[model samples]
Target: MAALLGPVITPEGPLTGQLAGDPFHPDTKHAAKALAQVVEALLRAVIGWLYRLALLWVMVDIVSFPHDDRPAALT
Candidate 1:
């Protein structure tokens, strides 16, 4: 979504230079804001995936127990 709606275009109007100033000439402030938002979303996704993976690992560990006739240690 960000890739498609990135690089904020400045209209040929009065607030062109002042409002859309880019020191590096790489991206306007609006585009930078969009890029920052994209980065934040990516971070959130990564964290969410990590949490899900941890839960899956825990479930796997619990289910992979040695379910033999013998019992657990008493001590």
Candidate 2:
């Protein structure tokens, strides 16, 4: 694999055109790690947003509909 594609170095990393090999293979570990991190961050952000949105809805409901606290005969 490495022998076939030869050594090709790029700004990102070195590539041998193979996923996994003995001494020559495309260095995709960094890219894969970075992508995973990004996906995790995005997921966390979305979850946080949803939580906040739900909280906002609860607050709005409470504010819009106030509970009446008075004696039944004191209307």
Candidate 3:
């Protein structure tokens, strides 16, 4: 995906052809880097929430189980 959008985002790419600017423009690179950081942070938060929810479910299951010393009588 990056390979395909890399050119389109760069200064010399078709998207910015009218500007006729350098391909390695600083502003463009900075924008992409910032976007990546935001995405990474969001993903980390989602994964952490999911992990906590799963842990809570396991704990509830463990607490709800009966701990009996005697076996059940025949029905």
Candidate 4:
């Protein structure tokens, strides 16, 4: 498995990169973890948008014709 160590040294302050991993065979666990994290973030954003959409629907009022229409004023 390749682990990223906190910035030790770099031209620009510090940078993160693969620290160490098997030279012959690498592990897929870390890759899977990274993928899951990205997917979770995306899902969170989508859910948030859906929640806002539902709230907006509730906030906006809708009136139907014939049922909610006003009658003519008396002379």
Candidate 5:
């Protein structure tokens, strides 16, 4: 699902470009753009997947065994 959706969503806007205001130096600009593209795509895909599955956040409780606490097993 991410594979398909990532490309579709990321390319909708121009990603192979300079930063919003602070442009990268000429030599590093291309690399920066590529890295930004990858990060954006991955973030979009992950967020989309989590949102679609209705798994934004589920409650979790941590429990410890050996409540007596006689120095843990390793001890």
Candidate 6:
């Protein structure tokens, strides 16, 4: 989902600029910023899905394991 939505959600900026071997080059900075934004968004989406899954698991567990408060001889 992130791959499809990232381009639409990410802000447009100087994707092309000075290209040099230096790490501080404008082009590199722009690329890095864009990549970081995409990665962050992807991570957030994953976290959200995981959270939902955990909630579902808890609910299922509760339903599957009902507490039996009766005495051992009651059966």
Tell me the deviation in Å of residue 25 in model 1.
9.8
Query: In model 6, which residue pairs have backbone atoms overlapping below 3 Å?
Result: none
lDDT of 6 by residue, 17-56 (tens): 2323456866578889999999999999999999999999
Per-residue lDDT value at 39 in model 5: 100
Superposed model 1: Cα runs more than 4 Å off: 1-21, 24-27, 67-75
TM-score quality measure for candidate 1 = 0.55
**lDDT of every model, 2 decimals:** 0.71, 0.75, 0.74, 0.62, 0.59, 0.73
Instruction: Summarize candidate 4's per-residue lDDT along 1-75 as a digit string, tens digits.
Output: 323444556444443344323333233466767789999999999999999998877666433224545657732
* Every model's TM-score: 0.55, 0.59, 0.62, 0.47, 0.39, 0.62
Residue 65 of model 1, lDDT score: 77
lDDT-better candidate, 3 vs 5: 3
TM-score of 2: 0.59
State candidate 4's TM-score.
Answer: 0.47
Instruction: Please give the distance, in angstroms, between residue 10's alpha carbon in candidate 1 and its true position after superposition.
Output: 6.2
For candidate 2, lDDT tens digit of each residue in 2-73?
577777777766744463443333345666777899999999999999999999999999998958888889
Candidate 3 lDDT by residue in tens digits, 6-73: 54654445555434355466766777799999999999999999999999999999999876756667
The 10-residue segment of model 2 with minimum total lDDT is 19-28
How well does candidate 1 score on lDDT at residue 7? Answer: 52
**Model 5 compared with the native: what TM-score?**
0.39
Clashing pairs in 2: none
Error of 6 at 13 (Å): 19
Could you tell me the C-alpha RMSD of candidate 5 in Å?
A: 15.5
